[model samples]
Target: MPALLDIERGFAAALRTGDCTMAAELIAPAGVSAGDAITIYRNTFVSGAVKALKLSHPAVERLTGAEFFDSAASAFVAASPPSSGCLDDYGAEFAGFLRLYEPLLDLPYVAGVARVDWAVNLALHADDAKPLDPGEFDVAARIPPERLVLVPHPSLSLLRLYYPGDVIWRAVLERDESALAALELRGGPFFVLVWRNADGVQVGRVSEAGFAFLSALCAGRTFGESFDAAPSPELPVLLAECLAAGRFTDFREI
Candidate 1:
């Protein structure tokens, strides 16, 4: 008999690639051929991945329909299997995969919608943090702007999409046909913010400047540098709004 580790590796390779020759030699099944058993395992794993993708990218699945979504998701599973055992953490690359997927190239917004879905899912699952106290913001506000760096809440994320993905995500998930119909097909440089506050995960549109500023902060830029990244007259007002909304948990003096 092959060593246990070697047998396990061979079986995994068979499941991933569907080339069961080595596994057939290593795994001696009594009733079913090793190749056939490996095929069953592979199919089951693919089905589980498809289900995970459906959960993560509901908007994409809705837009593409069930059969087509299943086909594409299966292909994705073959091309990019989960890195970990957690299915909930799978399919992070599904949006980018959709963008590169030949069949989905015509409907570009589908990928954008997938991005929105993934972002919301990420925020919902993100570890919770205590919201910044209003008093902390008040103290940070007293510090010289250049010396402070805002520490974003764990759930903060920003996306700049070339389509109105947020609208598509909401409409499809809500099953609002009229909202979908009213959306203009014109291309966009839409900016969206996804974060989990005390209430729950939330998504909202943001101005270009606000996106630039907050993204800079999220990337660990100093407050002064954020203003440099986004040179807007409304920086003060933007900071106030973020503080009010509990966008940051703390501020660091750099």
Candidate 2:
């Protein structure tokens, strides 16, 4: 029998190329013809990859139509197979891929929308934590500027797009709304923050300043330093609201 790694590599290559004959050469002889069984695997691989792509880029599919989206997914799968066993982690590079994809040129916002979808997925799968209590507010506030730190939820992600991509994403996902009428991209160069709050994962509009501020906090900047970087007069009020709303997720004192 072929070495396990060699067999796996050949099988993956065959799945990529639809080379059933090559795949058949590697399989153990069994009750069924190796070619037919290999074909099953090929189809299964395509289906799984396509499903991951669909989950990660649902907004793109909604924007482009399933037919076009499937084609793009297939092309992308053939070009770049999953490097990780965790299917949920697949398609991280899809946004970058769409940026250079010629067929999607007309839909400049597709990649950004895909990014939001991926972020939501990450948030859903992130580790759960107890939210900060009301009394901790004093502690969070009292931490000296230099000693303040933020422990962000694993699911939090910030996205900026040149189109109304987040709006488009919401319309597509919310079943109660008729998305077609609300599909126009507007208020461009949009910035958004997404995280699990008192409820489930929520997406909301944020200013560039807000995005930068949260990003800095998420990256471990102290309260004073992050505020210096953000430097917004209203930041105190917004920070309070975010904390009260369970938006901070976690933190540590420096």
Candidate 3:
């Protein structure tokens, strides 16, 4: 008798690769053939994965159209199955897959779009935390500038893309033909900031300087160092905006 873990692995392998021989040996005889039973499991597994991908990357599906997106998603699922049981945690590598997918080579920006979509998905599901009070940094004031670390909100993320993916994604969400038509994809290597607030998730492009400051802080640079890294002279203004947006959850003295 095979160990339960071995049986589970065999079943997963059959679903993932469509080779049912090993898995079939473990199944008790029934009216349906072992191959037929395994086929049902395979279909269910693939369809569930495809649905999760579609949910996570809706803009990708809209851009590619249903048929093409399903084909591409199927290929991706076969190549990379979910490591975790949680469906929401799946498809992190899908943007990378789109980049290397031969059929999507002509649409170079699709991968960037997928990246933005994934970021939004992550923000929406991230753990909830209250924004730090404006005075929270005061404690750090007593600590030397070199040792203070600004901690980003658990749901905050920054994405830099070669295309205006956030704009494209918003247009898709709004279902506005005019907005879609007005988009000019030629101008950017856009820096987008994503964070979840009390209302909902927000996605917007940030200035190079703003992004620089935020990136430095996120990377654990000291408050003084992060301010110095800002590309624009308006570091104070940007810091205020970040606070208002609830991008930082707390600070720690390192």
Candidate 4:
């Protein structure tokens, strides 16, 4: 009989490739043949992953329809299995896969929609953090803007895309055909801001200036450096809104 490690490796390969030859060599057939058992294992494994993918990317599934989504997800599972043990950590690459997926090449916005789904899913699962208190903001207020570095809330993320992903995602989820119809698919690079609070996960579009300002802060830039990076005249109003939105957990003045 082969060693335990080698058998396990073979079993994993069989699960991925749908060939039981290596694992079958060691197994005696019972009521179910070794090949059949391996087949069951593979199907069960792939199906669970497909379901997880569907959950993480409901917009993608809704946009594509179950039949098509299942087929594409199955292919993705075969091509890219989960690396992390956590289900929440899976399917981060599905959006990229959809972009290159042959059948989806013409419908490129589908991938953008997947990105919105991924972003929102991530926000929903982010670690809990208290928003910066009004007092805290007041303390940081005394510091010169050049010396202030803001810590983003755990759930805040920026996803910039070539298509208006958030609009499409909302339109599809809400079944708002009029909004979808009015969308100019070619009018992109859209910047999407995703974050979570007591109200729940929020997804919305931000002007390029707002995205740049928030993006700079998220990257650990000081107010001065961030403004230099974005150089927007609306920087003051954007900063006030960021404070009101509770997008930060902390801040420090250097």
Candidate 5:
């Protein structure tokens, strides 16, 4: 008799590759043949993974169409099965997969679109955090600038892409034909800010300087260092916008 670990390993391999020979040895014969049962499990696992990928990368599906998305997703699942049981954690490498997918080479921005979608999905599932009030940041202002580090909200993510992925994604999501028509595939070197709020996930474009500033803060750079990294005439305005948008959850003296 196979050990439980061996049985599980065989079952997983069969499900992942559609080859049930190893798993069949472990299964007790019943009404269904072991091979048939393994086939059923394989189909269920693949279908579930495909559905999860569609949800995680809706923009990619929108770009490729359901039929193409399903085909690509099947290949991806076969090559890289989910490591965790949680569906939400699945498809982390999908964007990278799309980058190398030969069928999608002509659509270079497809991978970038997938990346944006993944960011939004991640933001949706990020740990909940409260935004500090404008007054709260005042304390940090009083501290020695070199010792202060602005902490980003747990849900905040910065995405820098060379394609207009966010625009394409928004157009599809909003069902705006005109907006879709106006979008050019390589229309950007966009710096997008993604975060979740009371309403849901929000995505907005940010200037390069703003992106640098936020990224520095997130990396635990001191307030003075972060500001200096992206010093600009619009620095104050960008800071005000960050505060208004609740980008910072707190400030720490580090």
Candidate 6:
């Protein structure tokens, strides 16, 4: 019998390269020839990976069309491959791949959209916890910059894009809504926000300042520092709205 590592390596190669002969030798066989059975494995592998990619990048798939996106996703899988044991993490780098992918160079915003999608997926699976009560902030006249930590919800994802991908995403996703109409892709360097709530996936368009503010908090910056990075007359109001919207579910004084 082939060693487990060798068999696994050969299996990956055969699946990616479509060289079924080697793959056949590794798996258990029944009446079917090794090559024939290997084909089953290959098909299963590709289908599973592709489906996950589609789910993770629905907006990209919508914009690019199913066939193009599938082929590109297949090529991406063959190249970088997945390093994680979790299938959920399989397309973590897909955004980076789309950025360098030749056919997608014209669709620069697609990659940013992919990033947002992946973040949403991660956030949905994020740890469950009660969100902070907005009234808690009223108890403190001022939070110490060093000791204060703003907790953004684990499911909240902020994305910056060179095009209005968020707007496009909304139209494609909410097509069934009565309010949805024909959408023309906006020419933009836009920001997007995605978070999970009681209603499932929730997406919103945000300003560059909002993106910067949330992003800084995510990176562990103090509220004061994050606010300083993107100061605005309405920041206090904006922050309150985000909290009210469940952008951050909880906080701790770290």
Backbone Cα, N, C clashes tallied per candidate: 0, 3, 0, 0, 0, 3
Please provide TM-scores, in order, for all candidate models, with all chains considered together.
Answer: 0.95, 0.88, 0.94, 0.96, 0.95, 0.84
Each prediction's whole-model lDDT (CA):
0.87, 0.80, 0.88, 0.89, 0.87, 0.76
Q: Model 3, residue 16: what's the lDDT?
A: 91
Question: Candidate 5: which pairs clash?
Answer: none
- Please give the range of 10 consecutive residues that has the lowest summed lDDT in model 1: 26-35
- 17-111 in candidate 2: lDDT tens per residue? 98778778767799998878877888898889989989877778887899988888888888888988988889988887887789988878888
Better of 3 and 4 by TM-score: 4
Q: Candidate 5, after superposition: displacement of residue 55 in Å? A: 1.4
Highest TM-score model number: 4
Q: Per-residue lDDT tens digits of candidate 3, residues 1-254?
A: 78889989999889999999988999899999999999998999999999999999998888789899999999999999988899999999999999999998988889988998899889989998989877866676688877888888888889988888888888877787898899899987789999999879999778888788889999999988887786577777777787888988888888
Cα lDDT tens digits for candidate 6, 1-254 = 77889988987788778888767766676788877777788888888888888888887888789999999999887887667767777798898999999998886777876787787777667667566677876643265766677777778778777766666566666664433355345666777888876666677876778778888988888877888888877777778887777777655566
Off by over 4 Å in 1: none
RMSD to the native, candidate 1?
1.4
Candidate 6 TM-score to native: 0.84
Candidate 1 local distance difference test against the native: 0.87
Error of 3 at 118 (Å): 0.7
CA shift of 101, model 3, Å: 1.1
Give candidate 1's error at residue 194 in angstroms: 0.6
For candidate 4, write residues 53-161 as lDDT tens digits. Answer: 9999988899999999999999999999999888888999999999999999999899999999998889989999998875678888888989999999998989889
**How far in Å is the alpha carbon of 234 misplaced in model 5?**
1.5
Best-fitting candidate, scored by lDDT:
4
Q: Give the better candidate number (2 or 4) by lDDT.
A: 4
Off by over 4 Å in 6: 21-31, 140-142, 176-187
lDDT of 4 at 53: 96
Stretches of candidate 4 exceeding 4 Å from the true structure? none
